[model samples]
Target: MSILGSYLRLSAADLARAVEQPGWAEEFRDEQTEREELRAPSERRLHETGPAWDELAVLLGRCDLPADLVHGDRPLPGAEDWGYGPPRLLMPEQVAAVERRLADLPFDVLAAGLDPAELGDDDPHALDHLAAEYAALRTFLARTARYRHGLLVRYA
Candidate 1:
């Protein structure tokens, strides 16, 4: 199964609370579970850990981006639920740092660095689709950062 990821926005107050109480983000996860949905209206399903995510991570890593921020399999400090156990807190500063790094990512460089094999062979336009999705994710990250919101990334 493909591993999907979504980003939820957290208010400043919420961030503060989360810092104080690591389980604070669990409420959002519980709400989502109660609704029988993996994502809520306020959250954005940004990318999956396959071709698009993996290729982007590889290219970004080559650019000297922090491995923790770009690597798809990197363990999230405060992530929880979905069989991983209770939710943990994520600091606002950590999210902000990631947002800043994402903002400076060179899309052109990523595209140039991507290996054709990463896109799969069946779909001739896989690269184009990946690029478009990556652009949308970049925009989403910018918007989230502009609002001073912390991202709660959920993986499943």
Candidate 2:
């Protein structure tokens, strides 16, 4: 859970840094110290701390955690159905709503939560006929067999 929390904050910081200098983001560039010191966001870059906090709330809400405690000060509702993508802008009220939902749930639940569909375990063989070829299916079956064996070894 701590790891997840730290990752969320780090992700927010990375976003802020990317916004400040989209180019220097991938590579270090010096800006100060009479020589371009690797251009990194200053501590002040955390000015968007509120937004960062809000992002966590949105994540918690999306995960279906209770959020009433963290965001009681704000009036937004918990987020729902956020899909796989980069972070999007969120209103402060929305952040508050997410906070409220998170506050009400166990931290582990919030940290581990994600839409179950995102964790699909559907058999690839279910659509084997659509492949128009057996080569792909053969490879899939081979991989699946190996995976199943691995599971058996670990669990049974």
Candidate 3:
């Protein structure tokens, strides 16, 4: 009944190991649980988009983002469907590309370019969550790109 967007940071070695597991999605779940226990929940790795993932997807689509940056383009081999489908993985190179694209498209420009009504919202702060999430996403990508780390994306 509830859906949320989240991601897991992976090293290339871990990524290679992840693909070998038939239940990598569940494994990632456990990993997130462990991470939460170890560190305070972070907005950097967890998207607060909740059920508005579709809207954010549409808005990013309009912005001409990399097909895999938000929702991911490459499907993980053993990832199982958890409502929105299996988690997708973005390579380190893709992360860098997304970062570059985000740098080119400023948040102000993105907000100015899209209308709230088009995204099916009318609140005065219609883009507030989107802005916050986008900022988090930008920071996340920047960090990953700088470190050349891969990202595993999921919606559940």
Candidate 4:
């Protein structure tokens, strides 16, 4: 029913008739069917992994907000230009670093272990949280790093 399914079906049909042998045609069709089945899910999973990592990064940051500013919105001083808002912002590089630090950790530990609520609202708290997250994020950076590696690998 899918485009790929149709393409494989057509290809298999052509391969079968081309040789004028019913058995060979059937074999060709079967192999194409299996190959197509494997390709689709592999591509889909690769596509889904990117957004999953982004979502995971966000969840990690939210669960670990600064401890001091545990209450309301107060400008985090010099971060106005940084777009990080009242709470300190996490940079892309820093996020990757945190994933690496926390990669070996079990998912639950990374998810629930670090309490952002413990951080202070002051500059010190923001800086400390950034440092910790940067460290921890390194652990989980494998997936994204692989995606990046693949792109460069293709050219090489």
TM-score-superior candidate, 1 or 3: 3
Global lDDT of each candidate? 0.54, 0.28, 0.73, 0.32
Q: Tell me the tens digit of each residue's lDDT in model 3 across 1-156.
A: 757877777778777877888476466656665666566433234443566776667667767666467688788896778558988889888888878988887677877868778878788687886787777777777877777878878887
For each candidate in turn, give its C-alpha RMSD to the true structure in angstroms. Answer: 4.7, 19.1, 2.5, 19.7
Report clashes for each candidate as comma-separated counts: 0, 12, 0, 25
Candidate 3 Cα outliers beyond 4 Å, as residue runs: 40-48
Question: How many residue-pair clashes does candidate 3 contain?
Answer: 0
Candidate 1 residue-wise lDDT, 1-156, digit = tens: 655544455668775665566565566545644554555533542333333555555545655543244332233345445433333233456556666776776567667756657655457676776667677667766666667765555555
lDDT of 2 by residue, 55-118 (tens): 3344434455322311322211232212222223322333444444434544344435443333
Scored by lDDT, model 3 comes in at: 0.73
Model 1 segments more than 4 A misplaced: 19-24, 29-52, 70-80, 83-90, 119-122
lDDT leader: 3
Which model scores highest in TM-score?
A: 3
Worst 10 residues of 3 by lDDT: 40-49
